[model samples]
Target: MTDVMRCEAVADIATPIGHAGRVSSPVAEFDPKRVRRLRRYTWWSVVPMASFYAILVITGLVNGFADGTYAAADLLVLGLVLLVLTVEATRFCASTMRGLGQGRHHGAEQAAAFIAALLTAGCVLATKPEYGFIWVLLPAILAASIVTNATVSLRWPLTFATCGSTAFVVATASWRYGPPMVPIRFALIAAAVVAFTIFVLVVAVWFWDVVLELDRARSVSAELAIAQERLRFAAELHDVQGHHLQAIALKGELAERLVGADDGAARAQAAEVAELARTALRDTREIVHGYRRSDLATELDNAREILEAAGIATTVSGHARSVAPPLQPLFGALVREGATNVLRHSRALHCEMSILTDEHGSEVVLRNDGVYASDGTSGSGIDGLRERFATLGGQVRAEHRDGWFELVGRAEEPGRSEA
Candidate 1:
């Protein structure tokens, strides 16, 4: 259950919502497009293993039928055994690819396949002892495939022992029933088949493991980036407020001391304290409102980066200098809010942003396609933006039309502010 939930969470982080683009979390910096590509690679990597398994299993069945020695009853029994083995092999491959547990039922299936392989090999040997060396490779390869995917605790030891035991058994049988050199030849061939099949299985599993590791690393890196950003913000806030707070404390102490000897001096000191407090309050508010770091160009670049990360094609145009210095921060806020809305409220695939300044005012227009059904409903973020823009005689408009959503914010020049 835990593994299933983890896979689902990774999928949520790496798969775009609605097959468009909707991020799981704004801070999770993953590209669903890249993840999807990796998924394709993982799928293709398993194809060779499945193909080889099928060919080997089919070869065993073909050789058994073409032997021309077995009676009808013997052939029928051989066919049934091979059929069971093929079905079990198919189930194991499907279960492994689908990430299903190799539980007791799987153990039972593996045992059954092992028994079927042994029975089929016995049938081949009993009918045509001379052909046993060639036909025995089939069961060896199949057992290797099953062992490679097994999750049993002692699987490695078990695999080595099983392969070694099979080689010895085949060699002993060959010696007992065939030419003297046949035992060594059959033993070497069995060992080689086991080794080659294990190699192929390991390579397939490695490719999938790499894909999963990449998926995990993507989420971890995103979380680390957010943590670093938060630390940086906290440090900046401390720098801004720490100095003013210390000075305010000293002034308050001095004012208390002066009150005993000189009322006028105490009053002036108190006034200084009040002014210091107000200055600190203003600086704190500026920090909170993003005035200290609200460069319109930076915000635009950030928006583009975020949208592209979410698999959205984003284009940001125009320069920060195009807007009046006083209105730059407002426009920056607009870009940030607009990009955030596109990520959180819509499944946008492409976004366009344009910032401009003219004789009349400064304006920014943001547009995106794949607007969600509820996109036009104003949220608290948009409401706050409207209030901020209104303070400078500006307005922000958001609307959805023709399957596109647009946000436009404009603030008039100081000359036209009163009018």
Candidate 2:
């Protein structure tokens, strides 16, 4: 019964780990939309607020020293400070929303920040009427926001729109208030267009890379969850079914012997069989309720039982230690699968199971003295096993050589535990 329980436990542990192996690539699980939204918020809030504060401070210093617009500068400073506070508030709110997985509201927050920055630029233009060239800052901020929010290909067009707008506004302001030189005006516009375009592209690419990284992290988290679930189900099935099946088999044998020989004995055997069946039914119900996994030690014990049941002389040797609780299922599944393959495919008389911790990871190996087909051909089962191991960042090797078939797997130490 203990042996049966062990087999079940091993089975339970391996399921989720095997499943995780199937969906292991971090890239595959990334959500592009989430990354894009985060980029949009970060760029819109950080860049504009920083740029506005820098320009406001510089303009205020010039007015205080050279011109008697200190009062005007003071008002501008207050307004700009308020705008900075608004930007910070929006950033804080957006981060909170993101933490709660509310990505949809990110764009709205970004737009709000943009509007605040634009308002600050408007106030500056009104206060320092002579420094109207600073109005060019608004279009530059819009262009930077666009590049940060959108993809690389759209950057050029967004930059051009910003530069063209800035140039038109600055040119009109100059023509109205002061003398404008065609050569110098064109040169200034051209320089702003070129410089802002490069700036937008560089910042966009940087933010886009950040988005990709976030996507990768999200993908890995999803894969981990999936692997855990698979391990859990595997453990439950192994525990419930393993004991039930053995009990049924034992009772069935006893019933066969007692049949027709003695009525009382036969009736007793029948009762035993009935009880075993009921127990199995109840266990099945419990399994169906939910799947929970056992630790690695439990799984190793289970593997030994499973191999022994197959008439394979099995031995397990290792210091009893705990693995990450979530990973226990994965390791257990690998052992179960290895044992199953030995029983089902290989005509093996002897099997050996060993676990050891190395510098890199914990290694589990199963070896059988069996006659397997010489050709390297994998059926559905082998393919599935391969996929399972791959997801766990482990490798599986099966070789049939010199009347011995061996299967080996490794699992790395997890940084944290999962409940």
- The candidate scoring highest on lDDT is 1
Steric clash count of candidate 1: 0
Cα-based lDDT for every prediction: 0.65, 0.54
lDDT tens per residue, model 2, 1-419: 01112222323333332222222221111223344466676556454454554465466546654676546656566556555644543343333223222223345555455455445544544455555344444444444544445444665675565555455544444453445685247437634753564474355446545455444443343334345555667776787789878887887788788788877887887888889889888767544422233445655564554444333456777753744554555566667567667756775657777877766667777788876775677666656657766776767777766777777777776642231
**Which residue pairs in model 1 clash with each other?**
none
Could you give the C-alpha RMSD of every candidate to the true structure, in order shown?
7.9, 17.8
Candidate 1 lDDT over 1-419, as tens digits, reads: 00111323433333211112333453333345565665576556543444555456456556656776555776576557656665665555544553312322456667666656655564566456745555454565556556656665656775776577667666766666667787778777776776676666556655656556655554353333334435656776899899999999999999999997998999999999999999999998776566785567766766665565455678777877888878877787788778778866776768999988887898999999967777336888888889999988889999887778999999986667558
TM-scores across all candidates? 0.69, 0.40
Worst 10 residues of 1 by lDDT: 1-10
Tell me how many clashing residue pairs each candidate has: 0, 15
Task: Please provide the root mean square deviation of candidate 1 (C-alpha atoms, Å).
Answer: 7.9
Q: Which portions of model 2 miss their true places by more than 4 Å?
A: 1-61, 68-130, 146-158, 176-419
Top candidate, metric TM-score: 1
Cα lDDT, model 1, residue 150: 69
lDDT of 1 at 266: 95
